[model samples]
Target: MKFKTAFAAAAALTLATAANAQVGPEVGATVYGPEGNTVGTIEAMQDGVVVVNTGTYTAPVPANAFGEGPEGPIVSVTKDQLNAMMAEQEKQMIAARDAALIENATVLTADGVEIGTVTSIDGDNAIVTLEDGPVSLMRDQFATNETGALIVLATKDQLMAALNGGSVEGGEAMEADAE
Candidate 1:
């Protein structure tokens, strides 16, 4: 019957579409660092390693290097590793583009300090604003969730100085000016 044929055709199309859903590395996926900082974006995949270009560097890493982020999923990679891969001219352009194109990034310090969240990222650095508690920190220093607490990355002296209302030269004053 015509109805039966139409139904079968529709079903086949649906199945085919589902089967064609793209998987594996995709552009705009979040790339992470070993310490959990969003290092860069996925430029490409080669030889089982995901090539991440973090603007400053491009490196090939294991498939597990990436995870999810607010803008998208974050993958993991490192600067040194990326540099080594740069020897091959084929991957240079994409890697650099991927590195430079990253707009959002999870930021942190080298020692795993839970600094305030990064508002944005650019080549070689990011703009981080002070956030207020135990800010969740990834091992790589990018990507964190404050949840219910105010995220902070100040040292004991710094916090005491802040609470006590002190000023550092050049930096903005901590407390609001009295009315």
Candidate 2:
């Protein structure tokens, strides 16, 4: 009984101490790894997620993924491991973007409706021939569907509305959600 009581007191004290040592996730704060090594800097925090800039890439990690470390808030992965993973992700993203912006490729609407075909590549713009005329879209506005089909990142009605300078029939409040 004495051993149990002492253990409980010690555990409570440890918890109290740990609770006081928590590192706040703030912008420009250095985040550490489990072994107290530099993981990255917290670039931004929003909606319980922190965007950590690891020099190579900006990674969005859940706030709960961090733990109280000896020196600062610690993420599970090491700096090198996180950098490697981010590098791979960046590469894949570039590849997917490239695949969707090819010339002569069929451009489908966000809802899988056929809209146009890529007629020409003008610098950073992909000139897609829509129903009425050819429209140039930024490279980033192109996307690949689940089956690897090239698509514009907007609906048919949205595209028509933008081109005609009028409200679309089926357009919703399009939030600027970057892919």
Best by lDDT: 2
**Per-residue lDDT over 1-179 for candidate 2, one digit per residue giving the tens place of the 0 to 100 score:** 99999999999999988876565677888999877889899989999999999887799999888886677778989989998888897788668879677788998988999987887887777778776777767777777888888877778778676666554355543222111
What tens-digit string does per-residue lDDT give for candidate 1 at 104-132?
34333323454444454445334444454
107 Cα displacement, candidate 1 (Å): 44
Q: For each candidate, what is the lDDT?
A: 0.49, 0.79
lDDT for 34 (candidate 2): 71
Please report the TM-score between candidate 2 and the true structure.
0.60
Q: Give the TM-score of candidate 1.
A: 0.26
Model 2 Cα shift for residue 36 (angstroms): 3.0
Off by over 4 Å in 2: 1-24, 103-115, 122-125, 138-141, 145-179
Compare the candidates by TM-score and give the number of the best one.
Answer: 2
